[model samples]
Target: MGELARALTRHGIRVRVVAAHSPGLPVYGKIGDIEIVRPRYWWPERLEMLRREVGGLPVVWRKYPLARVQILSFFLMHAFVTARYAQSCDVVHAQWTLSAGAACLGRWVHRCPVLVTVYGSDILQVPRHPIGAWLTWLVLSCCDRITAVSHALQKRVVQLGVSPERVLVVPIGVDVTKFLPADDVHRENLILFVGSLIERKGVRYLLEAMPQILSVFPEYRLVIAGDGPEIISLKQRAVELGISRQVDFVGFQSQDNVRVLMQRARVVVLPSLEEGMGAVLVEAMACGTPVVASRVDGIQDVVTEEVGVLVSPANPMELAEGIRTVLFDPIRWREYSYNARLRAVKYYNWDIIVPRFIQIYQSLVG
Candidate 1:
């Protein structure tokens, strides 16, 4: 959201980010030319702060009636306040179904067109429930324009009864200059995985592939980055597989650290069961690293033979083979690396993507 705000501002459009008030952030702040506001949603600010940190609302939602009321209260307050504030805006652009649900109500007041962007789980998980389905459809039916980050998501929105004409596929782009290839390649025999250590990411399958990967080349090491609910279980799995020593768990690193790791690895692997667009894959490619990812959903759209190898999801042997294909052969690695960087620079750079967004905003605001 921060990146989008900054990008929009750079293109000469002002953006105000209205979101839940977290513990550390100020109620109001500024980033570049963008304004950020986080209004209070509940009483006893400390409890709200704790809920933001540890997901306290969900804990109480299962048993407490007041917690259920708080959820509705939060949503209602957000919708009312957002519409009130957005009355003077040219357009209301909301990202994800929940935010769209809130922003869609702006039509009742300001009568501005709302651009609802469906990304990943909002379109995937939200529509599966009865209430969530109604809420999502309410936003989709009310919004003036709709955008998704992937073709897969665009199709899903259409399946949900949204008109095809209202939808656009405008992927989130990477900063090519910030994540550019290294001046000199010092890549090790390392296979890097950057994402939350969750089951959906297929991290366990990747760990299962390690023994076979190590058998081919003893020097090869696996570095898993990112923190999530599955991190502890993943560590236990590594120990059970007896490849714990070869695997390094560097929990959640910054984007800059990720860029360095991508450039320094022989291959970046993502064996996800599902994906929206796999922006992480593009980021790795931008750093001149070849990918070994699953051929599932939108991940297939990003990885190709020119940049990386694609294997079926949940197949450790195939993933191991794909990793071997990149890391074991220096000639092929160089070729894939060159092609990856070329593709990233040519297509997925922010320089190329921001203009597309500008065009969309102009058409809507006009």
Candidate 2:
């Protein structure tokens, strides 16, 4: 969002980010040239973003009645807040499909166009819930326009009975300048995985493959970054597999630290069973790091023979082989590194991606 806001600002499109964060008085701020208005939602605001980020105390909201009430209350609150702020805006660009549901209500209040962007799991995983499918379909049906972060997600939107013409594929871009390779530092034999520690992320398969990886490249170490419900289970799995000493569960690091890790690793792996676009792959690529990922969803969109290798999801032997193949051949390693950087700069940079968004906005407004 920071990248998108800055890019829109750069294109002379004034952007005011409306964010929902933890409890506090509504705060207004600037990130670069863009203005931001963060209006706290509902009372207490302690449970703000609980559905999105798994950061709250497990409460009764997970139950149907309480959860539905919260959702309805939030829709009313969000719509009211958004309508007033978006009064002068040409279009309201909501981040997630669920947010799009709120934005759709806000649009009815304000009489403005709404463009909803799907960032992977929102479209891919949300529909699996009993009520989520109908809500997703309703939101997609209500939007003036829909932009998915990848072709895979766009296809999913179409599957939800949306016309092929209504959904556009606008891939998420990374800050190439910040994620660039550090030539002065020596890269290590670190197999880095940066994402939420969840089942869908396929971190288990990567952990499963670690013993084989360590068998061939004994010096190699696995670094699992990010946090989630499965952290303890994953740790226990590592210990059971006897690779506890070889794996590092660094919880969740700051973005700068992640960049540093990306620069230091020999190969970055995201063995996701499902993904939106796997933005981490592009970030690693931007840092001139080769990737070994599953041939699923948007990971397949970005990774190719030139930049990285893709294997079947949940297959440890195949993943281990792909990683080993990338690691063993220095000639291919050099090629992969060079191509990774090139691919990131060519396609995944914000400067290139933001214009595509502006185009969508223009078409919608017209």
Candidate 3:
């Protein structure tokens, strides 16, 4: 969302981001020239209500009800807020499909054009629920222009009945200056994985491959950065496989820290079963880290032979072999590292991607 907002702002569009359910009191801030309006709920009272409602339900039931209630509440609140603020803008650009619903309401009340972008989960994952499917369809149908992160996602939206012409594929861009190749001496024996520890993310496969990875390269270490419910399970798996000593779970790290880790790592791995556009892959490539990822839609788009290796998903032996192929061979590794940064600069840099979005926005507003 930040990336898109930044891109639109670069085109001389005045962007004001209004976020719902963000922590703390409402903040009006700036990232570069873009204005961000993050409004926090009055927590003590809201927390009390949430506690009462959430305390009794089983875990699975609790998630659905809580999520539904939150979405409805956010839509209501955002409608009120955006209707007022949206008056000054020509178009109300929503970052997500749910946000598109809010923007649609605001657009009707304010008579503004509504544009929405559907990242992977909003269409692929969220719409699995009956209510979610209906709401998603409504938002997709109502929006003036719909943007997707990949061609695969564009097709998915079309299947959802959004017009083929309405869907645009505008991938997120990377910041080249902030993420560049580290000094050769600084890169070490670290194998980094940066993302949530979830089943869909294939962290489990990475864990399963560790025994093979460590057997051949015992000196190398696997660094898992990010947090989720699966953290404890992944830790247990490491222990069960007797490769706990070779693994390091570093929870969540800031973008700077993630960039540093990417720069230092010998290789980056993301074995996701599905992805919209693996933003982290572009980030790692920008830092000259060769990636070994599954040949899923988004991963395939990012990991070309020049940049990194793509292997079959859910296969530990194949994943391990790919990682070893990169780590063991210095000539191939250095070539990929150079190519990764080059690819990031050429294709994934903000300079190139931001403008494409600007042209889209301009065409819509004009």
For this target, which candidate reaches the highest lDDT against the unseen true structure? 2
Report lDDT per candidate: 0.82, 0.84, 0.81
Q: In terms of lDDT, which candidate is stronger, 1 or 3?
A: 1
Worst 10 residues of 3 by lDDT: 48-57
Write candidate 3's Cα lDDT for 1-366 as tens digits.
676666567667788888754444345777787767754433443441222321111222344555435545656777777787888877787888867888788776777888887767777777788887888899889888988888878888888777899888887788898898999999989999999776778999998998898889999999999986678899999999998998999988998999999999999999998888899999999999999999887667788988778889999999999999888889999999999999999998888987776777678889
All candidates: TM-score: 0.92, 0.92, 0.92
Per-candidate RMSD, Å: 2.8, 2.5, 3.5
What candidate 3 gets wrong by more than 4 Å, as runs, is 7-11, 25-32, 40-64
Give me the overall lDDT of model 2.
Answer: 0.84
Which 10 successive residues of model 2 have the least lDDT summed?
A: 55-64
Where does candidate 2 stray beyond 4 Å?
24-27, 47-69
Model 3, C-alpha of 251: deviation from truth (Å): 1.1
Q: What is the lDDT of residue 354 in candidate 1?
A: 79
Clashes of 1: 0
